[model samples]
Target: MNDGRRKVLKAGVAVAATLGIPFVARAQSKPVKFAALLPLTGPFAFAGNAALEAFRDATEYVNEVKGGIGGRKLELLVEDTGYDVAKGTAAFSRIVSRESPDELLFVYGDSTGLSKALAPEVARLGLPYSATSFSSELADPKTYPTIFVLGPTYSDMMAGLLGEVRRRKRAAKIALVYSNSEFGKDPIPFAKAQAEKLGMQIVAEEVTPLSMPDATALALKLKQAGPDFVIMQGYVLTVEPLLVRAAKEQGLNATFMGTYYSAELALMQRGGPATNGFVVTYHNAYWYDSLIPAVEKIKQFRASKGRSISYKTTYYMGSWFVVDVLGEAFSRAAKAGKLTRAGVVESLNNMGDYNADGLIRSMKFVNHRLPYIKLYRANVQDGRFDAITDWITVG
Candidate 1:
């Protein structure tokens, strides 16, 4: 074996020793395969890279430290989709067809569009699937029997923000600003319904491209509408900051909040002063929240790679939770003597509250979605989000 392979095998042996398992026995066992699709070279590349690292670390932990799922080494097959639906679909097809069906127990999708596009194929393959998206459409257990979301849907997140608005300001005037993509437009109808249910006035609804080079017009529009709160949804990293800054410059007297994609340290850093007092919802703990064992593991893993822990983000935490959930399902399947894709789906369906090592609260799947959501305010000074409230269960 090459020097690198030799070292890795030695480390695996050491890990096996710690688990009280013989290396020879583990070497004889086969591997459980997982296929991952990531947006590595596209608009979401930064977030995708962070998630990729988290998956790598989680796979290492499962194989080396945890002695793999049921004594079979965890093998991960990853491909870059560049955030394109067609590319993602092609990648999924290639992976499923190329890999052994029995060995490939689970698949991870990169985007909401991809998840929805491949739902039929996933069901046809009879494999349990997870994704980076939390689209409400994917949460229907009847429609997507094997699909699982890591947290609340976009609609639930919007509802959480609206509930917060109503709690803080009675009969508040709210506006919904979103991008023009599947991700951005996913929760607009639900959010509007929620506003109506809360008796909040829907003042302005604006749609912009994912990359809003000049948000001055939108800012002016929002300024004129003068809503008490403006909820930004379906943006990954750019539009929200520009809108928040432009709106602030335009003297828009509204509290700005965002859905999950806008809740990141990168946003705070990019928006600087404008992001001050900005609130966003998150389904996973931040990197600075090292109180959790999983977070600590991420820290150590990054340190081992000669990188700072600060490089990790909320996206990384989310992806780690994805893999951890898969590990849990695999374990349960093994226990049931049904370690195939269908078995994993059955295990996921029967799962109760799972906290992913306290990175989030005890998550119970309601219609294949976790109903936990938490609010965080941007601390521009530190470029991090501070919890504004405890975990709120969304209906």
Candidate 2:
């Protein structure tokens, strides 16, 4: 200590001692924050809202239940990007600049576009990035070291779908249908290659807009192609049902299928009769599977707060699965005493088979994405999805 400062501190201590007063040092516990860029108001509001709810509950579980990480409470910092790429990038920039690396452990972004746009920046900052996107492009650890996909890449999901096609009918004729967007088109090439590998034929490849100008025309085109099955990509709730109805009206007897969002319980309700035989692939358990521990925790937490729900969307369940994975990483990092971004990434890379109470099956990230998934068949009569196959590793 400097002499002048030391003498002043000693004089203060002596005065306090003579007055029977004691001096104490004060320190505040810091929070390990996971900053999120979510689209809470625009096109993807439904998704963002579902995810936000999970983030909130997961934060509570960590801090209140598990005593937080290394005694530093976990915090969720959300910046609404309104599903806009430009705004998402702006939020990422602001968050990285404003948050201290010591406290900011992870960042969760909205979509494939935002993930691609911020790849360079995330790598530069060395901040661990996870996203709602499962684009095949984002699975590259070499290019985007800090970025990871929450589930299997679209390509991996496609493999599971096409494998199902091959299972239902060897040498199955498959038609590819997707919206002409990044989400829609990301897995086509890979699907084609996988189809070829599995000895299946690509009968028709159809592209539609986010809003179908004429749904009938697309259905007629598929009928003309005469494929035994049609696989959809790049859409959530709109085109799958419409085209299935149109194709049925045309007397086309092809099985229709989708992956991820398409297989959601919401889609089953939305599609009605059209979704009866529709097939989809997913990586995690649905929200209604209350027997699962983590999901049970969500149910319990909400009920304790008088905000319980009978059911939630797939996005909600999927979002919780993401949080559980992050929690695991944070826990590992804390135990190792390297609760930083790099430390979390190291733990993630080496996280071989994580059993998060069956939120996901042996959740493992290969090439920064979960390569395992399961197949489900929608039963319109029950308004629920039934598992058709056990967990399959595709990617």
**RMSD of each candidate relative to the true structure:** 8.8, 3.6
State the lDDT at 14 in candidate 2: 89
What TM-score would each prediction reach against the true structure? 0.91, 0.92
Candidate 2 has which clashing residue pairs, if any? 184-234
246-343 in candidate 1: lDDT tens per residue?
98899997999998888888887888798898999988878778677878877786678687666567788888888888888898898898998889
lDDT (Cα, 0-100) at 389 in candidate 2: 90
Number of backbone collisions per candidate: 0, 1
Q: How high a TM-score does candidate 1 get? A: 0.91
Cα lDDT tens digits, model 2, 96-213, are 8998898898999988888888988899989999888889998899998888887889999998988888877999899999988888999999999989999999999988886664
Error of 2 at 35 (Å): 1.2
lDDT for 151 in candidate 1 is 88
Give me the runs in candidate 2 sitting further than 4 Å from their true place: 1-28
